[model samples]
Target: MVAKMAACTGSKDGQDSILEPLCFPEQPASSTSAPSLQGPSVELLVCLFCPESVPLRQKDVLLKHLLLDHKLVIGDVRLIADLPKYMLYWRGRFLEQPVSDFCSVIKTNSTGPLEKQEDYFLLCDVLPEDRILRERLQQKRLEEVLEQQQLERDDSSFHRLCMFCSEEFTGNRSSLLNHMAREHSFSIGLPDNIVYCKQFLDTLQDKLDNLQCLYCEKTFRDKTTLKDHMRKKAHRRINASNREYDRFYVINYLELGKTWEEVQSEDDRELADDEDDDWSDWWAHPVSAVCLFCDHQSETMEQIYSHMKETHGFDLHQLRTELNLRFYQQVKLVNFIRRQIHQSRCYGCQETFECRDDVLRHLVAEGHVMTLPDASTWNQPQYYFPTYENDALLCTLSDSDEGENGETSHVEDVPVIAEDVSELRALKQSSVLNQLLKSRGCSS
Candidate 1:
């Protein structure tokens, strides 16, 4: 009965009755059309305030845009919180990154699971502003340090502190020496402290190298040059008898309870007094005529002489010295003028003039006096010798005719040649003056 029933059930569809499967095997999906869990197709950095979006390529460029273009300050909590919402595409998806993760990566300085581009961008957004501020502060600090160092160097160069007394001094060695002598009674060559004394002496020698000529007030590089200048200019011969006259001594006006401010005010008053003098006008309108004695500009030789005598306090000795110096200077200037005369040029200005008269006019108008002494005076015999009655030496002019007649005729207050050294010796025995003259091969 069961076989008949099965046959009948199959017979209804028996002509094409094949056993049909209840379930079919599942077909694999096409790889090309499959959806991926990795997120979106394009990566972009979108602006929060505008519709502008930049390709997520470089972190720095994006950060610069945010800071400069959008005027955003990085590291703000609100901005960082809102950053993911503005990011149109992140990790190939729109707003796929969590705000916490994004902020964490932005704050980090190291590379990790996050893409390097995103990591750097985050770092740039958070740290650059602070970094720049710190760098600027460091640069300012460095500059301040350098300025302080320079100030210290300048102070050391201009001023020195006494190692023993800790007193600061701003003048030369002679001033320091005088201070030591006066304040401490310290003699430089004491046998008790010979080594220390020698060291101090060496320092003084070094300082003396930078001294000025006491007579001419001209600065020299070293003592040798100063000595040479004294010899060549015959300053020693002129001031021979007055040994202490030209010596440089530092006077401590401050010791008398006078302040530096008071001294400065007194100096200013003196300068004001000088400005009220006639020479101030002379200086204001500089003339071509320079003084032979001191390079002082004057309209005439008489004016020059007056200036030297009154302003410089020149004695007969100083006047004779200046006269001698002037003679040589005049000779040089005359030669220069002669050479330039043919070219119709003013020797002082070195500019071409219309004629010799024009040059002369320019020279005279500009106070360029180049007057030579009378030819008669050039050949006259002159002498400078100290008199026992006065500290200053007397200049005498000897009559040439009287000299030829074997009789010495003395002209009062004029430079003359002395025939008798015995007469000078009879007047005074100045060992210092004798040694000075002897060094210059002169018999005093």
Candidate 2:
């Protein structure tokens, strides 16, 4: 018996439409051909869109064909409903089934109403295998975007801002510290709350593209030009008066060769030594003086200057320019130490005492001596005089009456005198007898 029903269709109003019947031919009976060993063959879905009625065994392949060839989406409800016109047969059944019957069957199997695109696929049972994979990929992309946003937020949170000028900085702690110290004249010992700002550091980097002098605030095209300017202007000597403050930074530079604890131990040892012990010996020591640029050391300033010039192509001025920041800080510290040292007070402790002696006592008791060891020697003088032992010249000190008295005084081993010192006293004193005779109004 042949059973016929209207083909499924969809109207402009999104309602089902009845259409003419689509034919399905029955399998021919096997007479002369041998009976197949297999049971009833698996049914194939056929596309009516092709004149040949192309057969696809798998639903996924049919869906891909519909999408790729027919330009139809599998899961779309209206499209799926309208698809019966293009579906000659499904599972060996003619496409002449009632639209309501197909809808009813799908509604009976699925949990929800057939409203969404995925729901239509679920009803039709042609959902792709990689559909789940696509969803997981989309979900993974969303998670990655969220994680990147969170990291950006956290990074912004760590950025530091200047308290005084309300400027922003993007650099790390060291760069921020250098900026604060240089631009704002901000002390190194800032309050813990002060922070670096992202904006300021970025701006500072842009500004620094042109080499600028930190001391004179002059901008230069390159380092060579800056060096020339520094040499001609004598800008390196700008920190000469501030060497006391520079001394601390120099000490800090030395400390970089070793750990803080090690430097502290060395300082302790030095402090424990006797007062009469020549502190000049420490000046010749390796740890005491190190090159600002390369950490090279020597006994005297002249040797260090020579080393810097020969090895690093840096003269004294160039070396000083390189170490300008250290010199700047040193000047400030020296001034502070001088002020506090003479005031009979401890700057770190902020305690006042009656006399300098009492202040030293307090400093020793509170361990401030270790902290500001330079303060103890603030009263001492620092002198630099170059001596040449090889060159010598001799001159005699004589009374005017020496020739008349047939007596001559000769002196040997005197250094050559570059300038006249005829009015000055001789190195060797005249005899007291001659001086007494001269003073007593008697000729020697």
Candidate 3:
């Protein structure tokens, strides 16, 4: 409970009026409700914002006023650090002046200087500041009241069923016993066990009747162990009839109106959706890596290793060996393509086949179409031979060799056209994978 204080209006005199009066409810003087803000009884010097003649009592009230009103910016008001040098009196008189001492007494109870405490403490050194003290006490009382209100809100009394199924401790006991016997099929006989015969018999009878599962017939000393049996699969399979008996979940029919089936169905649906997202990251890569595979730049061996392991069936070791071999192979093929493009000549159209073809099969398969001039002279639209494009002898002998020796001439004629150029272009434009490689800054 925070104490309430009236606004401070300035005094007519040139001095600052620091304190304000407060109104509090009349209570027994013995009540321990005032905020404990007693300072040392010693007459220590305090800083004042008025002439040196201003009374010390006024300074104490001013500190309390500043703390309650400007607590956010100025914390504990006792030690004057960056406080304003003007004072407004209760009668609304305003005076401005530098405090003569520029220092205040260090209260005995406080561990450090007043400035360090959070803005809640309204410190005032003057012993006679009764009006401000009363307000602080009232505020403390208010806080206690608020705390008690919060505790009242937290206490909830809903359906309170006894752990033993024999008796339902609802608002009515007779109806509970009748419902237990008729609907639950509970027995009436009590048991004979232990020294406290009547008390133990009553307790045992309640447990045996209330226990939804008779197959286990296990009477736990505590409710927690009995609940574990209901949840475990072994108990569920044995006491299948007890599936409908949930003590914690049962709600009063007069208050809630919710059925057990509705709550169970909602819980099962959420469990199924959570299972699919566990595998979402297995096949999908980050969107940024898509461009790297689209263009066939020579991929680093490490990059290819990761790509093959993730996208293809290959793992790290096999991918590493394959990638290293592929890199050098592509490099050699690109160089060969450059040389063939420079040396090749065309015999059919009398034009260089440097980077051209009558009609390339793979190129057409990739959506490129070209009309072949003559099938006999062109030899089934062969790949553009960079070397044979300018070599007339190589082009002339290429077709004739196939006719003369068939398989032998066909093998020998292969060198007349360089196929490595196409392979080089394919490797250059189709394979580089850009992945965030872990920096190898540390060694094992």
lDDT (C-alpha, whole model) for all candidates: 0.39, 0.39, 0.32
Clash totals, every prediction: 18, 13, 36
State TM-scores per candidate. 0.15, 0.16, 0.12
lDDT of 3 by residue, 1-444 (tens): 211111122222322222111122122123333333223223322222233233444555545444455341222343231123222221122123222122233333367676764423222334233234434444543454333333322223312343335343433222333344455444332111011222323443465456543447676555566656655624422232343232112221111223345444456655566556576556752222111111111124445435534543334233223333232333332223223222232221223332323212223343321222343332212233322122211111112222444443334433344434676566554543312222343321
User: For residues 122-179, could you state the per-residue lDDT of candidate 2 as single tens digits?
Assistant: 2243334223433444454334333433333234234566533557766334445555
Q: Best TM-score goes to which candidate?
A: 2
Better lDDT candidate (2, 3): 2
- Give the C-alpha miss distance for residue 270 in model 1, angstroms: 60
What is the number of residue pairs that collide in model 3?
36
TM for candidate 2 is 0.16
**Which regions in candidate 1 have their CA more than 4 angstroms from the true location?**
1-158, 163-165, 189-407, 410-444
Worst 10 residues of 2 by lDDT: 386-395
